[model samples]
Target: MPFIPHTDEDITGMLDVIGVDSIDALFDEIPKELRAKELAGVPSGLSEMEVTQLLQARARIDGEPTCFIGAGAYDHHIPAAVWQITTRGEFYSAYTPYQAEASQGTLQVLYEFQSMMTALTGLDVSNASLYDGASALAEAVLMAVRANRKVKTTRVLMPRSVHPFYRRTVRSIVQHQGIDLVEVDFDTETGQTTLAHCETAGDEPFAALVVPQPNVFGVLEDVNALTDWAQSRDALVIGVVNPVALALLSPPGDWGQNGADIACGEGQPLGMPLASGGPYLGFLCCQQAFIRQLPGRIAGKTEDVDGKVGYTLTLQAREQHIRRSKATSNICTNQGLLVTAATVHMAILGAEGLERVAAACLANTDRLAQQLCEVPGVEPIFEAPAFHERALRLPAPTEDVLAALAEQDILGGFDLGREYPELGCALLVCATERRTDAEIAAYREALASTLAIAEAA
Candidate 1:
C-alpha cells in the first residue's frame, strides 16, 4: 500500500472522538520527566518519492554481498511464488485464530505446516512454531525436564559442539527454573562431541542429552550412539537438527532404538531470507507421548456439522488458554505468517525437490572447503565428515581476514575465535544450494588475496 498521510481534519476528528485535545494528551499518564522531548538525531520527514529514492540509494551502496556465513541462519533460494501468495490480503493480515470458524484458511495452513515438519523430522507431533531455533531449544529443554520422570536430576547434558548462542539462550531461560545445563566438550580432532566426552558427565542421572546432528562445526555426530546411550541411562535425547540436512540424513525419529524424544531447530533454511537476522521461524517436534508437554499451539483437521472438511487449533496449552501455573509455556502465539511461507515453500519443492537442495548444499560446501584448503596456510580444522558448512583454520586472524573480505563486498564467513577462542584463528564457512560455482570461486580468490596481503603486512 502507498503511504497515505492523514489530513489535519482527520486528525482533529479522531482527537475529538477520543475526547483528547491532541496526540500528546493520550500519553498524559506518562510522567513528563520520562517522556522524550523529541526524537534526537532523527532525520526530518521526507516526501514519499524522496524517501523511496533515499532507501534505494542506500541499498545500492550495500549491493548484494555473496553470503558465506551460515552459523545458524542460511541464505537459501526463496521462490517468487512463496511470498506472492503469502502476502495476499487473507494470509498477510490474518490475526490469531481465536475463532476457528472465521479462520479455516489460516488453520489449514498451520495444519499443512505441522504435517510437513513431522514428516521431515520423522516425529509424531510438531508444535505450530516457536520464536526461533534458540528459543525453541530452550522450550524443548524445559519440556524434557517436565516429561522425563525417570531422571531425578534436572541436569541436561548440553554439548559445547551445539551452537553457542543456543546454549546461552537455554541458560537464560531455564536458569531460575532450577534446570542445570552441563557442558559436554567436543573432540578437538573431529570437531564432534563423542561418547567419551558425554561420559565425562559421569554416572549421575540427567534429564536429557542434546544431540546436534551436523553440529555448529557442521560435523555430523554419531547420533545413533548418542541417542542410545542417553536412553540407556533413562535420559531423553533432544536432537538439535538442520531441517534441510534431515532430508539426506536419518531423521531424529530414527536416531536410535527408541528415537529422540524431542527435536527442534531453526526453520530459516526452509524459505526464509537472512534479512538481517530474521523474523525467522523455529520448529519443535517430538514423540506422541510428549504431545501434552509440547509448547505452542497445534492445528488439527476435522469435519464440520455438514461433514465437510475443516481446520482448527487442536491444542492450545499456552498461558493464555490455561491457568498460568498449569500452562505448558508462557509463549502466547505462533509465527503464523512465517509458517505460511515455509508451508508454501515445502509444498512447491516437495520431498524430492528438498532432497536435491540438500544434496546441492552438501556438494557446494565440500567443493568450497576443498578449494579454500588449496590456498597456502589455510587448512581444514577437523577431520570429521560435515554437511553444508565446515571449520577452517587460517594462519591469519579470522576477524582481520573477514574484515578484508568484507571490504571487497564478500561476507567471507563466521569468525570462530569470537566464540571459540580455543580454536584460534578458525573460521566457519557455508555454501548453500544458492551459492553458484562462480560465486564460490570468487570467494576463494578474495580470501587468497586477503591472506596474502595479511602475511605481507
Candidate 2:
C-alpha cells in the first residue's frame, strides 16, 4: 500500500462531520495533564528506501551471539517450513474468524493448536491463546479464583521460585480485585518450594496454589506433594510449566492423585524464536470441569448441516462477544499468527521427535554445567536435579562477568541477584538442543576468562 497524505481540506471536512473543531478535540475526554504535548524523541519521517537502509544497518549492529540465557524465552531450532506456511497470504493476513464459513482454514489451524496444547499438558481442555506467558498466568490466577467454588478466599499461594516477572504481572492484574498473592519462600538448598512453606499460611483457606516445574532456578519442585496438599485443602493447583520439558517430566494434569486444575506457560520453546523478548505465545489449559471459566476463545470441530466436518469458534465468553457483567474475561483476541507457527512446528515434530529434542536439551545443559563447574570459584548453587537450565554461583559480581562475556559476543545467562538478592552472585544458564558442544565450550572459556579478569581487578 502506498502512503497518501490527507490534505487540510480532507481533515477539516472529516472533523466537521464528527462535530470536532480539531484533531486534538477527538481526545477531549483525556485529561490535559496526562496528554503529551509532542513526541520530542521521535525522529523525523524518512523515505521508504532510507528507512530500509537504516534498518539494515541496525540489524548488522546486532551480531548473532551464541545465547545461553533461557529465563523464560528460549532459543530453539525452528523448522524452515513453520514460518513459510504461517506467513502465506491465506493465514498471515487473516483476522478474527467472525464468520465460520469464510474462515475454515484459520479456524481449523486454531483447533489443531488447542488439541496439541491439551495433549502436551495432559489436560482435558485448552484455550486458543493468551497475550504471553506472564499475562496467561494472570488470567489463570483470575480463572482459579472464579472456578474454585469450594475455596471462598481469594488468596493464592505463589512461590518465590516462580519467575519474578510473572509474579509481578499476576499481582498487578489481580490486586485491584481483592486477590491476595501470598509469597511462599523456596528452600535455599534445593532451590525448590517445600511443603513446609505453605503451612506457614496457617489453616486459613487460599483459592489456588501456583506450582512451577523446573522453577526459575531451573530446579524441579516436588509438585506431587504440593498438588496433593492444595487439593486436600480445597485449593486449586495451577502449574506454570515449560512445554518442551513436558515431553520428559510428568505433565501437570498428572501431578497428584487428583491432578492440577489448571496449567499455563510460555509456548515459545515449541516453535517460536526468542526474537528479543517476544511477540511470544502464551498457552493455557485446564480440566473439562473448568472449561466455562477458561478465558480467551476456543475452536471446536463439528459436523455441518451436510454432515461434513467443519471448524468454528466456540465458548467465546469474552466481553466483546457477550454481556460485560457475565463475560469470563476481557481478553479480546488470540495470537493467531504465533499459534499457526506453533501448530505447524508441533506437527513437523511428532511425539518421538519432541522427546528426542527434550532429551538433547537436558544432556546439553548438564554437560555445560559440568564443564563450567570445573572452573575455579564456580559451582552449582542448588543440589536438586534440573531440566533445561541451572543456577551457578560465581565468585565475582554476576553483572560484571556477564558484561565481559557480552564483549566477546557470547550471550551469557541471566543474573539472579537482580531478582534473587539472597542468592548473591548467582548466574542462571541454559543449553538447548540448538546449542553445539563447541558453543558450550566457548561459553565456559569465556566465563573462566571473565572471572579471571574480575578476580585480577
Candidate 3:
C-alpha cells in the first residue's frame, strides 16, 4: 500500500494540540548543525501507478532463481489457508493485546502460538514471540545470565557452528553488558562442536552454553553430551534449535541427563515464505524455572468468576516506555501476523502432517547431497548427520562456483568462506520439501559442470 501523508489541516491540528506553532519547533532540542537544512537525495514524489511500475521493473532485474540456499531464512511450502486466514482484518489489523479485558481473540492466538512452540521445543512454557531468530537468541543468552544466580562467571561459551549472523547479533547485544562470548571451534572432520570442546572450555564461571542443533553448517551437534557438559559445569544450557528438525530429532527439553534449560530458534520454516529476507518469526521457550526472565510477553489460559475460558497478557517484563534498568527486555510487541500465520499453518498440518513434511525434507536433502557429492571434487564436509541443509567442500572457491550455477539459473548455496575462513571452498546448501527430484538433479548436474569448468579454467 502507498503511504498517505497527513493533510495540511491535520498537521496544523496536531501541532496546535502539541502547543507547537510550526513543525520545525518539534525538534528544537536538537542542535541546528546536526539537522539537515534540506532533504538531500530525496526522490521526487511519483504517482501510485508509476511507483508500482518502477518497483516491478527493478524486481524483474532481480530474476528469481531456483533457490538452494538456507543460511537462515528458508523457502518452504506454506499452506494457502495459512495466509488466507491470517490476512483477514481480525488478525491483520489487530493491535497489541494489552487490554486484558478486550483482546481475548488476539490473546488466544498468541496462547496457541506459545503452546505450539513449547510443544515443539519440549519446554514447559513459551512467549508469544520475539523480533527474529537473532534477537531471540540474544534474549535467551541474557535470560540465562540473569537466571544463573550461583554462577559467578560472566562468560558465554558458544560454538562457531552457530549461525554467524546470530552470533554477531548476540555479541553486539551482550558485550555492552560486560558479557564475554568465547567461541568454540568445530571438530575439523565432524564440523560439530563436540562435547570435547566443552571440556576444553573448562570449568569456567560461564553463565550459559549455546548449543545450535543442525548448526550453521547444517551439521547436527551431539546435543545430549554437549548439554550434559554445560550442566556439569553448573552453567545453563541454551539450545538454539531448528523447529522443523525438532519433529525428527530429540528436542532440547529431552537433550541430556536433565535436558536444556532454555530453547529458542527461528520460526520462519513453520509457515513463512522467504520474502527476500523477512518479516520472520522468532520462537523462545524454556522450563518453568526461568519463566520470569523471559524477554517477551506470554499469554495464559484462565477462567473468570463466571467460569468462562479467557486469555490475557499474563506477563510483560518490557519497560513499557518506563524505566529500563529493571526491565527484562525492551521489546514491547509480538510478531502477531507472523505468529498467527504459523499457528494456522501448524493447526492445518497437525502432528502427523508436520512429521511427514520434516521426513520428506530430510529425505529430499539427503538425496540431493548424495547426488551432488557423487560429482567429482564435491564431497560432504561433515561426518555428523544433517537435516535439510548440509555443507559441501567444493573443488573451487564457492563464489565462482555459485556464479557459474547462477548462469544456469540456480540460486546455489551460501559461501562459507566469507564468514568461516577455515572452511575453504565450502558451500552450505539446503533442499526443502519444495524441491523436486528434477530440481535436485539439475543442481547436481549444474554444480558438476560448474566445478569442472572452473577447474579447467
Q: Which number leads on TM-score?
A: 1
Error of 3 at 130 (Å): 0.8
Q: Is candidate 1 or candidate 2 better by TM-score?
A: 1
- lDDT of candidate 3 over 64-160, digit per residue (tens): 7899999898888999999999999977887987776778878899999998988889999999998889889999998898888778777899899
Q: Candidate 3: deviation at residue 363, Å?
A: 0.9
Question: How well is each residue in 1-457 modelled by candidate 1, as lDDT tens digits?
Answer: 2476888899999999999999999999999899887898998888888999999999798888889999998888999999999999999998989799999889999999999999999999998999999999999999999999887789999999999999999999888899989999999999999999999999999999999988999999999999999999999999999999998999999998989999999999888889888899999999999998899989888899999999988766554477587898888889999999999999999989899999999999999999999899999999989999999999998999998999888999998889999999999999999899999999999989988999999
**What does each candidate score in C-alpha RMSD?**
2.7, 3.9, 3.3
Model 1, position 251: C-alpha lDDT score = 98
Off by over 4 Å in 2: 1-47
**What is candidate 3's TM-score against the reference?**
0.91
* Ranking 2 against 3 by TM-score, winner: 2
CA displacement after TM-score superposition, residue 192 of candidate 2 (Å): 1.1
